[model samples]
Target: MLIFTNMKWQQALKDYKLYLKIERGLSKNSIDNYSRDVDKLIKYLDENKSSNLPINITSEIIQQFIYETSKTINARSQSRLISGLRSFFDYLIFEDYRASNPLELIESPKIGRKLPDTLSEEEIDQLINAVDLSKPQGERNRAILETLYGCGLRVSELINLKLSDLFFDEGFIKVTGKGDKQRFVPIVDITQKYINIYKNEVRNHLKIQPGFEDILFLNRRGKQLTRAMIFTITKQLAEKIGLKKSISPHTFRHSFATHLLENKADLRSIQLMLGHESITTTEIYVHLDKSHLSRALKEFHPRK
Candidate 1:
């Protein structure tokens, strides 16, 4: 390993975070996650009374930290932690601060492939219809649900949606997804109609804050809606309908992809629509409903 002296772990971590943000173009949420991984290692070092800096830290120490972490967290979380540490060490090697990565031989936990939960078409209809249109915010909530299910948007993308991003006439909305990557997703007229009603009837009347004038979804005071507020809205509706499944904003996205796949939408198209970087990510929708696979197999297979 390349030897260095007087380099502090805190300073190295700060520089690594900057590299993640600027050079790697990661989002704040992503940067925070990476930083948290480093923080855990620092905490481990402190607890063990190891004065080792980043340059001097060894694979043995890191492996010990990983071993300790695995005891308290699930396999999936352990896998993520190991992956994060690998990235950090890789960065150090790339910067020539170290000769080799500590995590080169480390492997992630072997967890089963977990499928996302999805709503049936009827269940989705029930949830949307459950919104009380008589209330002023009801139309807005309906629109939010429509966009979530229709466009397969992440919760972060939904809250960050701006008025300028909506090109209804062109039949697509510009979505800024993970890594600040922008893509256009087509919006159906029904989804458009609901959004327009909310914009014209309810959102139009609000005294919008100066900074939030272009935000599509807003609260009573016209401030941008927080992520927790969206979750609360969805949770309250689930309770109102007495739906049995534990769900979140992400459930709608999963339902969107699953439903489309069931209706014979090609995997490539779904990948594009969902803005997935890999087709493997989109392929999980296939596992959501097994009957679809059986039907496809029986219909096309020679034995059938």
Candidate 2:
């Protein structure tokens, strides 16, 4: 017989951190990442309950979370949430906080297959040239577009990016993605050149908002730029170029993934770069890009 002790969700999660470190021999960053995942679970539990507590969590409660998340998040994400719950229960069992892990038999959501869209080298160049370099933000816009294609950042991550995150000296940037997870993504010399040009020639001239002093991108008002602004900018540029494809700041992110996969970049490495918690999410883009096969059809198909 085991006696479950810890009642407070925060306290239990904290103790789980120690177990992941001292017992599991994981690095500090890894332990912290796992903790954040568990925290999200607790938040879900608390918000849905009138009197939330660790003891109140049931299999059905967790299942409800999976269903709700599947509506908004992808299958890859639902899998990560399940993994987080599995870890939480593992910690409970290790600490004797529970007699058994509730997640032992729970199944994960099945993410159906879907391919990602990518731009060809010519298409990418066309998009970059679409920026009106004569304008004040031209250099900045060009660089931002390059960084998006180069770094594969979500709009939120790109907008929330900070000057301090740049590690040009080491050829990488410390990116903070969903759940505040940090990962260092490598930057090539070409991306570095463009970004540095914008930083020196453009971002330096902004009026500079007080609290957002270190933010990388800013509006004319000196405040940080929002994701919507980036979307609007991209949409306008796409129309100006007479392009018919529907795209946004996120298209660049997808393009980044497709380009990398087409070039034969490793799935594990791509997953790391994309800030995904599981490789299953990254694998969706592997054959999904289909650049090689699709181009052949366009080039040789008699219907063309």
The model with the greatest lDDT is 1
lDDT of 2 at 235: 87
List model 1 lDDT by residue over 1-304, tens digit each: 1122224777888899999988988889999999898889888877787778787688899889999988899999999888888899889988999999888888898999998888899989999999999998999999999999999999999999999999999999999998898989999999999999999999999999999999999999989999999999999999999999999999999999998989888899989888888899999888878788888889899999
Best of the candidates, TM-score: 1
lDDT assessment of candidate 1? 0.91
lDDT of 2 by residue, 45-76 (tens): 65665344565467777777777767888778
Q: Model 2: which ten-residue window has the lowest total lDDT?
A: 1-10
Clashes of 2: 0
* Collision count of model 1: 0
- RMSD per candidate (Å) reads 2.7, 7.4
